[model samples]
Target: MTNLLLLALSAAAAVAPADNGGAPQQGLLPSSPWNVDYAEAECRLSRTFGAGADGYTLRIIRGANLKGVQYVVAGQSLKIRDWNHSGTLGLRPGERAYKLMVAWYRLPTGESAFQLLADDALRPDEIASTRGLVMEFDGAEPLVFAVGNLEKPLAALASCYDDLLTGWGIDPADIRNLKTAPDPLDLHTWHLYDDAWIGKAEKGKIWMSVRLDVSETGKAVGCHTLSPSGSAEVDTKVCVLSVKNARFKPAISTAGDKVKAPFILKIQIREQPATR
Candidate 1:
């Protein structure tokens, strides 16, 4: 529910192909070959739906184009809904939007393939509104890819429910009763940001990156810092990263002599298990 990824995007304003109906394109144009080797790359994504007798299930796939990846809904039958190409296909009204899952496989060639990256459920608003959802891939060969699905109506309804809950700030009675379902093939993408204060007068720009990893549960871990601007002395003793939302908060220091004029704290949110 937290918009951590959106915050990362605000920092890195990089460009990629349009998410709409654009033709299949390769990585960043006029850029050097991605030097980073991703032989051991992985990624995963999940969303929680309202509790009910009939729970929700969602899946996602990433590729050079929608046609490349193969999938089946509620069954093993290979169905080419072509949600991406058709521009308007996968949606069911009054249903929740399903989560997307993606994995990167090692290719026969030493150079890895950034294609066929992720697959996910589509929100109706996302379908009826934008061309498609664009995802940013980081590594040796960083690239941007688009995804589309007909399941927008279901996603839209689910989104409405989320808005209602968030707006009312109502704690569902079943909050503690929620559980994570089994996922045989887990793939997900995570974005990381490097933030620091340049000086007392100005905040430094934020640096960003992404990581693909298998889904799991763990404690949040990382280093946080506050850099000084100009000649101001920096005191970085009081910085904290929010565990619930992966946000950073700088603590005020009473060390008068050690106080720096222009400094900002750099906070890093380590990976942790995803839970409702």
Candidate 2:
């Protein structure tokens, strides 16, 4: 990871600015290459970076006073309870640096979550024009993100964000309170009891908490166990099944605008003896 970050940064540094003869017109594309999904009153713009299936998923969600993007790498098997750290954001190669908070969640299997936040929500043009982003996680290998050719997608996202804000009669940068908390996750919806897990259940209770990154559509794009259950299978199963089966009411802002937010799902599985 360290080597990859260094090499990518060096390459970004070597590229010279395009010469438009004056004012350095970048000739950014008119459209963005990203995909957008709207649910639960929020709009989620997503795009994947890097090659193969091993890259990362970049997700943007709008909130009351906060709007940020999350970097997700799949198939990470780290079982750490929780982590809170600070990091630096290097944008446009040698451009000015921004301070960001690093929050991560380690889930079942090999899945990991890392989120980045700026002091305030960044505009669409700022995000689209950024050629490269280097996320320096403290004491860990930094990850390089490529953000070229995103004009059209970002423009679309910006328009969508503005439209939503305008419809709510709120400023683009203002914050609001949640009108109502998001709905709780319903395990039965996914038929979790039908899984082999129920067959292996003993006379003990299994309790687990899952951190969910719920999208605008009320779908969980990412799920991680908040704490370990003595049983790895139970922990993993709960996290995996919840993402697929769990449902939320979708959070609403005080201004009557729907948005995406992080939610915690608590689950308790209790076994009963067979009754003849």
Candidate 3:
């Protein structure tokens, strides 16, 4: 989906947790403090926690063809150091844990948000039926929530997910073989040498970012530069090369099926002096 919230939610479904032995037994979980609200038009199922300064919202949104989860944290500031590539968020009921990749963003309301995503649909039963919810992220201490009843809320969320897919004419079976998109470029090969681009390559200090939408045939349909690398010529060159020269390993939706996907490229072009 084009919306950031939906994108994040779809990602959450992509990497769902497996039933490891420690999942909470199917029964009535302890009373949770979470409050649920459904927005059928948007296909969103949400739960709010902590009011005012210490508040956060947990959301599961159904996108055009994907599902995702968002943890919106507010009433505080986040330091750059708080975000590390190695940081992961874990959700556990009992001891069975589901680890998810975490991405951070700033909301228009000025609140900071963290998202967990994958590229597939999530099984609502796994989460709704579990109890004793505890979440751990980024080396910080675990946060425990009183998640009393998950059955009804998760069921509603699942329904919204189905509604989105059906409304968009997508079949769930077609998504089974879908795998996350991967980068095709060996960026190291593109780092300019001192003699390559002459003046531009002398220092090679260029910071640029690009976004690409790839077709199922492994071709980049469109590419746009997000940040310029100082030189217009250099910027244009990078985008052109990425779209024309880069080879992509098409995203597979089935053993023999390929699906369209989006890819992002961020490069800080800098030269390295000879070590010897």
Candidate 4:
């Protein structure tokens, strides 16, 4: 796993100023054309790079809200020994690089993968104007790829995100000029039970999609589980805890006025291992 110190160092040493001009190969591996998927509750963009033992698939996923874009990499190339690592993402023709904490996930294919969930998402303009991406991990060498034109794919994903909002009774038009989506004012309080209780149940993970009705005051007036977690008790616990701790910064308009809006999130809950 990459450490924060090394991640920062790599960014400064390797990342360069991005522009509409294509990124230097810099040993950047060739990649497949970008693919878009309108999943059950998320939008996904993915591509594969490298060959043989060095091959890997990179996936970008966004849920119902405007933030929390997750970057996932899967393949036999990277081993997962820890729950977290430090990683960086740099865009081609993009000036700044983003550092993130990468968490491990085992895919259905039994491949070990690392996931980096970004707190902020790039604007649609940025996505459309980009041509490649650079990713770095501590123990492994960086993976650079020519991601191809994303204008149409990104627009389709935006439409998918809007459709997700509509499912929550939100009108896409009402969210125009949105400055920020709802986020926890106090991260500590928000995570106290962000994962539903599974202490007495099976040992696997429970995934659920949830929607929160945020009042103008940023209070969670209502919480609803839009997707099932396989257990009724687990689902109830998730909503109950989420509502009690939902002090958030309500969505803000570009004009700086706070507006009541629904926020959607995809949550994964697993039984915490007992500590000695």
Error of model 3, residue 38, in angstroms: 8.2
What ranges in model 2 sit over 4 Å off? 1-33, 51-53, 64-84, 107-110, 123-128, 166-276
Q: Can you write out model 2's per-residue Cα lDDT over 1-276, one digit (the tens) per residue?
A: 444344333433333343332211221111234777653334567766543323455666553223444433322321222444777876663455787776665433345556665544455666666775556655443445556655676667666766655554445544336555466556567654434654454436454455676776788778765544456787777778777777776777777776776565555464323211
| lDDT (tens digit, per residue) of candidate 3 on 1-276 | 123233223322333332443222221122224434433223555554444433445665544323335443322333222344433333334445566666665554566565655344435665665553444455443434345556776677666655544553445454344554544756455443234444563245444556566788777777765455666777677777777766677766546567876555656565323221
- What TM-score does candidate 4 reach? 0.74
Per-candidate local distance difference test:
0.25, 0.53, 0.49, 0.68
Rank the candidate models, highest TM-score first.
4, 3, 2, 1
Stretches of candidate 4 off by over 4 Å are 1-33, 81-85, 93-95, 138-140, 185-205, 271-276
Question: What is candidate 3's TM-score against the reference?
Answer: 0.50
TM-score of each: 0.19, 0.45, 0.50, 0.74
lDDT of 2 at 238: 70
Between prediction 2 and prediction 3, which has the larger lDDT?
A: 2
Count the clashes in each prediction: 35, 12, 15, 3
Winner on TM-score between 1 and 4 is: 4
Query: Cα RMSD (Å) per model?
Result: 20.9, 12.7, 12.0, 5.9
Estimate candidate 1's RMSD in Å. 20.9
Q: Give the Å shift of residue 180 in candidate 4.
A: 1.8
